[model samples]
Target: MEGYAKLSSLISTDSEFAMYRKFGAQNTQSLLCYQAELISFGDDLQQLAASDRRSQDTDKRLHAENWYELSRVENGKDQQIKKFDKIRKDNCLIQQTAIAKLDRLAPYNLRNLRRWLTRSAFGSSFLYGLEARAWDEVYDHDLLAFPRSYAENDKDALPQLFLGPLLELFHNLIGRLYKKGTTKDTLSPEPLIRYYDSNILRVADILITIISSGLPIASITALNYINRTITRLVVVAVFTVTSSLFLTFLTSLRRTENFAVTAGFAAVQVVFVGTATGAGNGGLLRSDV
Candidate 1:
């Protein structure tokens, strides 16, 4: 009775521990509940950390990709700019070179006509003929394209007249002197000098005025000879032939001692020489002659 009374008093005093005192049931239940709550909180924290890590990785990847793309675009643009700059520089250099060349040529070109006039009579006549022919060709070409204006009309004329034909004439004449078939040095300076004195300067001045006034000379077509190889070799030949013929005719007339015969022979010689000289100067003399 004394033991039973002690046990009953302990149980009544500790209600929470009453079951544990007998079998530990209530204490175990409370411990299990607290453990479950702790586990749930730990799992919640781990999931939150994992989600944060993934979000940071995605942001980093996006930033890196954007930087790479931006760099590529900038590089491409830089290449294009460099290409354009190089092209612009090349064009500028070409333009500058052309301008420099043109400037260097101006003085020589300006003096050509005057220089040719002073060269020799044959040279002057030949050059004058060449100039006239070139002008005619240019005029004809311009007239074909713009028929309303005459060849003398500057407004409708082709620029080729001023640029191409004039330039070509000088080039061709110089080239002819240097060519293999013609022994230019063998030519007697006397006839050329005489021809120059008689015709070259005046013709050059007249040509210059006509060209400046944009008028085609009436004599231009008469001067422009056709392409003939023999024509070039005949000038010196004609001069020699005419002098020989005149001397022979004079000797014959003096021997005959007849005034009428002498006059007739003289007239014949004059006609023949005049015709030969004209033909030679006009470049119409045959190469075989």
Candidate 2:
């Protein structure tokens, strides 16, 4: 019995025995860490894929809504146009009133009025300090509110109210991953995955909003670039044609009997060449021609 107790104590307290157990624990912890990393990466990839799908669906929905709104607005075109005309008249009256009020306040002459209109905040401003109540009274009476409201809401509210939270959520997710990788603590990916799944729709909303907003700006920029390129090409073609005609005229005159005429033509050719090559009057000489 004493020998048995001694053997048990040796097995329990021996450094080698303790080391063996410690090695097993370490291996188990390492496995868990590896498992966590793999799971986190897989989950993140799956979430991203799911978010992309949701974004596509959201994009479709927004497109459908835009078409629907556009159609609705189009259907009421005559009434909306008439309402716009009325608003324009009202705005003119308001501007006249503002000008009169300013004149009364300052006793300005015609020249001063012209200067003030050019320099004053009222002339440069949209609505010109018009109150919301006044705007509503002038513009909103008997008009279908849906079209204007829809456009304004989509332009102003969707990006900030709808996408802002999703951006913050994505940032939080990235920070969580970074923290997990850098920290020494044993962390499970399950909770993070759950959180991502819950917020995937919000992420999709953000992506859709960004895509929609960016597309219009991108299209406009491309259109402007194309327009500028076309204008430059037209200008160059015109300049080339004109120069060719002038050179042909000069060539015809070279065979003429009049030496003075030939000499004058040569002088004009020199001036033309100099102007075309940007030697005189900067680049404006080409435009002058």
Candidate 3:
């Protein structure tokens, strides 16, 4: 009776159990009845252990099935690519559902679920192929599930889903830089840099914004401010260096020109640089200079 009362009190008071009640009332009742039976069989220690194992196995299967249902992709044309793209677009919804399902499980069950996901082929591919926005969603969800402070104390408490996706996105960005041209055998930095600056960097900025927003203002010490300032300076320095190199390349291309053509090429370079600088500065600044 004492054991049953304690179990009842825990089920009533624990938030995790509360979620279980909300989503799986039948399972909750079955768990309670199973516990009652274990308590009644006070001398049968073997039976108690066997029953507990069975209960744990059932919970693991239930949680695994729930997650699989939410994440599984349907078969269709270009199925693999389409499935992954759909998963990325629906990442927010999947995160919500997965978290809710996770909340209903015990810590051991949670570990089992994570193990199941990590071992599954579809799960591995889905995580490794996540794009920028999808990776952001997963990162955010991981942070929420296991904050830095909590993760410091318990390393394996939460799933490490963010790392694979982040690495995959980085790898994809690098691969995009070396795309082969059909006509010319020459490698072009212009298209590569443009794509990098516009897509990958833009996504990186968004991730930074998300991280920054979560940081406490009180934690913004002088060192933190200085670091941010130094980062901005570094970015400016890189921009200046790249711009100078591009100008040098343009000038070198005009080395074979006659005097008039060289003058015209220099003038054109000046106009092009002015236009580019204006556009780079948000196109609102005057181009008079």
Residue lDDT tens for model 2, 36-123: 7556656664554455346555543343235453234445553323433443453433433343332111111222222323332222
lDDT of 1 by residue, 82-190 (tens): 4334444544334333433321112222233234334443233343444434323233222111011212222111332333354446556773455343222323222
State each model's CA lDDT, in order: 0.36, 0.36, 0.36
Global Cα lDDT for candidate 3: 0.36
Residue-pair clash count for candidate 3? 0
Q: CA lDDT of 12 in candidate 2?
A: 41
Q: How does residue 48 of candidate 2 score in lDDT?
A: 43
For candidate 2, the TM-score is 0.16
**Candidate 3 has what TM-score?**
0.16
RMSD of each: 47.7, 37.1, 28.8
Please count the clashing residue pairs in each candidate, in the order shown: 5, 0, 0
